[model samples]
Target chain A: MSQFENVSVVKQANVYFDGKCISHSVQFADGTKKSVGVVLPATLTFNTGVPETMECVAGACRYKLKDGDWQSSRAGESFSIPGNSSFDIEVVGEPYHYVCHFG
Target chain B: MSQFENVSVVKQANVYFDGKCISHSVQFADGTKKSVGVVLPATLTFNTGVPETMECVAGACRYKLKDGDWQSSRAGESFSIPGNSSFDIEVVGEPYHYVCHFG
Candidate 1:
């Protein structure tokens, strides 16, 4: 069996976003990496009016919806965004680390 | 939302296991608690000959199988145990935190 066959631990890494926070990449811990960029950070919102799923691993943030409703999340919190909509967010403190999976 | 809606963060709590090392409980973070004890820790082993699923949240431990092959796990690691078997474990460091779900 592979070294990871019985392992479920995934390490976290940092990414550099240049003003535009939209990009995608397949990160592997085994020294191999793949790049896939087709989304925009500004256009990719969640928990407010965006169609996406976001999980917060650290820090906090506020998501403002198009209809004026807002949601807040802190470290260890997760939120689900409905499809066919968009939203905005402001980092509450420090740089936030989130995992976003989109369709 | 009932404060738990849209939140995926689960807080960890300490469990006091007697020398027997076997107990069951449904732990909730919302001030509610449930207790279920029907399994023996000595008979509920994993990754070796135990048919149980185990997750390591903190510290490290080693599982020595009956066949002499052993498995080790550190913090943040998780492993699945096959069904109908049992194994033994030895904590390597400080008290370890693990979550076991059985059928």
Candidate 2:
């Protein structure tokens, strides 16, 4: 069996969503597997005024809304929108990394 | 509606497991809700020799397996075990934190 098949289902990794988010999975050296979705800076926005949300899968990030209001989020933080809100977000300083899933 | 009812189902948070791990959920300031499982050092062990695992929901941690061999895990990392393995983990320095669910 592949590494994924050996381990019991301990937990599912977190997922984040953006227009250009990419999905991928990895198996650690100790036979653990993590599946994740990633959104980069270039593809962080959508044309419609949809709310973008993410859960910190592994790091910290600073985010902002319409003007320049900022907020910091760490792993396990989750957010969402109702499909008719306007928002913009960027990684605080380094690359913005999170696992995401969208509707 | 409560904040949990307002946000769309963005993504489910990760879960970790140890025998005495406790489960809890929280809603953040921006109307975001985060559900997490906490395993403090006191109740972190089991008598049946089951494997203990955690996903770094927010910060960083250093862990050791059988004999003080150390490994560092950041957020997004996931691990699991069959019903018969043995292991031990610590938060490195600060309090250990993670969101978890179990079967």
Candidate 3:
């Protein structure tokens, strides 16, 4: 996917996950929150409070939706995870650059 | 700083610094490159080819311009690095969150 254009950023925040990942949160004018983060070569499970759309800005990863099959996403690719559910993401070698949008 | 704001992202890129820092590069609609990144708790020096204005998005870090004073900047703060010069950034407790503007 391309960059997010014409976005009004309101606030920024940092998220820590021990030494696994650190995501920088971006809050926009329309009350939407997005995070640009890097996930190292590890497998992680994330629980979302809101529906999230994750875009692979760089690198690649594999994911399995709740009770679904594992799929892969590369640079400029995207996937959607339903809110209140969880998904598993696994990465290898290169740390993945991701842009996550919550709605 | 709170968030970035209305931004049109044309492309997303990843920047690496060995293991010290990893930044996700956001290329905006007007051709500006802004990186939202995390600096591990280490002192690293960077050389810039263009004038850079760095905003502290989260945590804090100490920096000194070329032959300048060493100063600390917390979240919601910012510093500028001149073109063709270098700056030293030191982080101790927390990884510093930064938004760097390049011109």
In model 2, how large is the Cα lDDT of residue A49?
Answer: 38
Top candidate, metric TM-score: 3
TM per candidate, chain B: 0.52, 0.44, 0.86
Native-referenced Cα lDDT, model 1: 0.42
**Compared with the true structure, what per-residue lDDT tens digits does model 1 show for residues B6-103?**
11222111122222232223334443432221111232343333355566644567776556577787666766656665566766424344555453
User: Which regions of candidate 3 are displaced past 4 Å?
Assistant: A24-34, A67-69, B24-33, B67-69
What Cα-based lDDT does every candidate model obtain? 0.42, 0.42, 0.76
Residue-by-residue lDDT tens digits, candidate 2, B7-80: 12222222234212333333333544343443333323332234434556645556555444667777777554
Candidate 1: residue A86 Cα off by (Å): 0.6
Better structure of 2 and 3 per DockQ = 3
Question: Where does candidate 2 stray beyond 4 Å?
Answer: A1-21, A24-35, A40-44, A47-52, A92-94, A101-103, B1-103
Model 2, DockQ value? 0.02
In candidate 3, what are the lDDT values of residues B1-103, reduced to their tens digit?
A: 3555566543343545644676656655666667777788889899999999998877899999999999999988899988999999999987787788897
Which tens-of-lDDT digit does each residue in A41-97 have in candidate 1? 232343333355665645567776567677887766866667776667766424444
Error of 3 at A64 (Å): 3.1
Where in model 1 is the C-alpha error above 4 Å? A1-24, A27-50, B1-103
Q: For residue A37, give model 3's deviation from the true position in Å.
A: 3.3
TM-score of model 2 (CA atoms): 0.29
Considering summed lDDT, which 10 consecutive residues are worst modelled in model 3 chain A? A10-19
- Model 1 chain A is weakest, by summed lDDT over 10 consecutive residues, at A1-10
